[model samples]
Target: GIIFFGSQMITRDWIFNEFGCKFSITIDILCTVVSNFQVIVYTVAALSVERYIDAKLSLTLNNKFRTIITITCIVLIWTMGLLMPLP
Candidate 1:
């Protein structure tokens, strides 16, 4: 996001050849998508860890179940992250 915004700001008063413009656009899209995916993954991981710690401290879930739940959450997180960027 920052990359794309900065590129736009920098190019506002400048002229780019066709190749340069295309390359800039491609980089912007790639950066945006990758950044979004990274943010989602980090957020999900933090939340998952917090939840797991809370459950562990409170003794609300057994170790095996907690492990299973954590794995499931991770899988879902990656799946959502991958699919959400398709649009």
Candidate 2:
């Protein structure tokens, strides 16, 4: 967005021709989708904890491997996010 906005402000138009235009558009869409998906991921995580609390069950995430699970989730989320914008 900053790149697009600044370029347009300086030249009053897209200076990068057709291919650059498509590349930039693809990048912009990917960033937007990834950020939106991150929000969804966090929301789901919160909901899972909430559901566990409501059920009066021991939190499954109390294990020593929780950090590994968290990292794996993040990596999968980003991988999906990156793939989602491709043709």
Candidate 3:
């Protein structure tokens, strides 16, 4: 995200050709979308934990199950992030 913004700021006149400009914009958009989605996911996770504690629910999970759930959530987040940039 910083890379995209910094590049644009440093080259206000656009040093790259048309293709470069388009590619840079695409990357910027992808980064922005992914970061936004991550923020949403993190916020939800935090809220879920807060609610769970408030309700005094069990927070226990087997190691394997926890790993699987974490991996699945990461994959889903990235998949959704990448798909969001599509036209």
Candidate 4:
């Protein structure tokens, strides 16, 4: 598979002290890619919640609490996405 070769290349094509970390990276990529659908679902859920907040009330989104909460949700979603994999 393309993924397998790409992962193997990182380990085989380069010399490093990682002791075939590329293999781990390959597996991680496969796992993460396969798991991405779930991630997208979560993202859509977050967006839906945001939409509900925007429609549920009459006040414009100028209040500190609403603004902060919206920003928090957005940031949390992205942060988790970025940090989803670690060894």
Candidate 5:
């Protein structure tokens, strides 16, 4: 995210060759997508679900179950985030 914003700020008045420009733009887009959608959005959702489970099923939910659930959510979030850009 910082890289994307920094590149934008630095490139405002500068110019790059064809390959450099394309590579910079690709990095910016990839960073923006992963930072905004994958990390922030999905993480919040996962935390919310975890909290809900903890609150509602505190007695039944053990550390092992919670760990499994958390890992599954993380994997799903990354998988969805990465696959979303694909056709």
Candidate 6:
């Protein structure tokens, strides 16, 4: 929903209509794409690795420790993506 607002603001013509600069839409598009890819791909990979570790340990996957691990994984995704080059 926040992205929807960003998309609208990105396309508005009034400022450019006055300033005579064309705003290409690719910036928003690339940001939208890379952000999703960054989050979803990393989260899924984390889940997969957690599942593997849980299976190897022969333990139920929904323990408090697992929850902590999942949150840490998501935080890692955000931190790592911050250091990565954005599209």
Give the number of the best model, judged by TM-score. 5
TM-score of each: 0.51, 0.55, 0.52, 0.50, 0.60, 0.57
> In angstroms, what RMSD does candidate 3 have relative to the true structure?
7.3
On a 0 to 100 scale, what is the lDDT of residue 15 in model 6? 42
Candidate RMSDs in order: 8.8, 6.5, 7.3, 6.3, 7.0, 5.9
Give the Cα-based TM-score of candidate 3 against the true structure.
0.52
Candidate 2: global Cα-lDDT?
A: 0.69
- The better candidate by lDDT, 1 or 6, is 1
TM-score of 6: 0.57
Q: Rank the candidates by TM-score, best first.
A: 5, 6, 2, 3, 1, 4
Candidate ranking under lDDT, highest first, comes to: 5, 2, 1, 4, 3, 6
Evaluated at residue 15, the lDDT of candidate 2 is 81
For residues 1-87, what per-residue lDDT tens digits would candidate 1 score against the true structure? Answer: 344457668887435567766777786688568857775776777697867787678566677886786688777766666555444
Query: Residue-wise lDDT of candidate 6 within 59-81, one digit each (tens)?
Result: 55557777798788888998776
lDDT of 4 at 81: 64
Residue pairs with clashing backbones, model 5:
none
For model 2, give the 10-residue run with minimal summed lDDT. Answer: 57-66
Write candidate 3's Cα lDDT for 20-87 as tens digits.
76787777777787778775876588558656754673456556775676677667766775566554
The better-scoring model by lDDT among 4 and 6 is 4
Off by over 4 Å in 6: 1-24, 60-62, 79-87
